[model samples]
Target: MAYTFEILETEKIELVIPLVYKLNNGKIDKAVLMERFSDMITYNNYECAVIYDGSKLIGVTGLWFCTRHYSGKSVEPDHVFIDENYRGKGLGKQFFEWIYNYVKDKGCEAVELNTYVSNAASHKFYFNEDFKILGFHFLKKLKK
Candidate 1:
């Protein structure tokens, strides 16, 4: 199947909120997702990549660019998801191949990301893509 991809600009990020909702399986309200995406866009360090088959959204992923002391400039792919209708079709691999080239063209020396420990499927996918475990991704949420 033919597909199109774009790393959406801040002004067009609303296109991604719905897909993010799907990624979260509706655990978070769409309104709250929109709000969080708005905040992230405001930072100007994040953008989202999406795959579309004509008018239908097939997948979405978040790309965070930053200068890490350890990795220098890097692109972190977050919340990667391909629609259930399209999974196991090599779309995930192609999507990440596109992302890898995109970030490398932009001078990213490394790529880093966090995935839930429970997401064994993603861990397998990432490993197949040659991503190695560097260390634990620790986190502490703040009171809001």
Candidate 2:
């Protein structure tokens, strides 16, 4: 299958919102996700990398480019989700390769992400990709 990779414009974030909804297992409200996406695009400087198999979206992931004291300019990938039917087909490795090259061209020194602790499958995949656990990702939800 021919695949296309694109950096989805901030204004076009809604294109990937449904895919992200699947990432969250449909637990969060779409309205809430929309609001979060608005904030992410407007204030958080979020970018989304998407893969399409001839106009049908197969994978989506959020990217944040920033300067971190420890890593200089880095790309933090978040909420990475490939369609259920598309897993185990090497699409993810291809997607990451695309993202790595894309960010490297942008002068990114590293890639970081926070995966849910309970996502054993993600842990395995990231480990296979050579990602290491540097520290815990603690969170305190102030409001919901």
Candidate 3:
């Protein structure tokens, strides 16, 4: 199977949104997706890449470039998603390798991403890809 990574554009937003919604397990609302798409278009310091099998969008991944006083410099993978049908076909690894190489070429010292503790499969994949677990991530939910 052949795969290609294309730089995401506003024209492909519709196709990308559904895959992202599926990856997030339907937790994200359409409104939020639209808002984020707008933000992605307006933000010049970030990069978004989508994987395609022929003409169909199958995966999406990206990172925001930023520098912090305490953390120094780093790039964070905002969202990484592979379509259910494409999972386990070695596409996820390709996505991460591409992201790592892209970030390294852009002079980022490190890349970071967060996944829920319950996602054991993801944990194994990340570990196999050589991503070290630094520590725990604590979250505080705000009542709406």
Candidate 4:
């Protein structure tokens, strides 16, 4: 199978939102996500990379570039997902390799990502890719 990877253009982002929702377990409404994601792409330093097999979109990951005291220039890839029908075929590995090269090209000092704690398979995969458990990630939501 021929695979192609490209940075998705702003106008073409909707094509991957379904997979994004799937990654979030469909908890967030699409309209809300669309609006927020559009705003993010418009106002933030974020970009998405998509992998396609021929004409089919097979995977997507959102990359956010930032500078931290520990890592200097870093790229935190979020919303990583591979189509259900396309998983376990080594595509995720290929996608991450693409991400590493992409980050390196951007002169990033490191690449970091957070996966849900309950996702053991992803934990194993990430470990195999040499990602370590740096520390705990905490969050607190404020009421509007």
Please give the lDDT score for candidate 2. 0.89
Query: After TM-score superposition, what is the CA distance of residue 25 in candidate 1 from its true location, in Å?
Result: 2.3
Count of clashing residue pairs in every prediction = 0, 0, 0, 0
lDDT of 1: 0.87
Better of 1 and 3 by TM-score: 1
In model 3, which runs have C-alpha deviations exceeding 4 angstroms? 68-72
Return the clash pairs for model 2, or none.
none
By TM-score: ranked, best first: 4, 2, 1, 3
Tens-place lDDT per residue, model 1, 1-144, is 988878877787788877778877799998898899889878777888999989887788889999999889999998788888888988899898899999999999999988889889899999999899999988899999
Q: Model 2 compared with the native: what TM-score? A: 0.94
Estimate every model's Cα lDDT from 0 to 1. Answer: 0.87, 0.89, 0.80, 0.89
Q: Which 10 consecutive positions of candidate 3 have the poorest summed lDDT?
A: 6-15
Error of 4 at 65 (Å): 0.3
Which digits, one per residue and each the tens of the lDDT, describe model 2 over residues 17-128? 8998988889998889999988888856578899998988878998989999998999999989999888989888999999999999989999999998888988999999
What are the runs in model 4 whose C-alpha is more than 4 Å off?
none
Candidate 1's displacement at residue 65, Å, is: 0.7
Alpha-carbon runs more than 4 Å astray in model 1: none
Query: Which candidate's TM-score is highest?
Result: 4
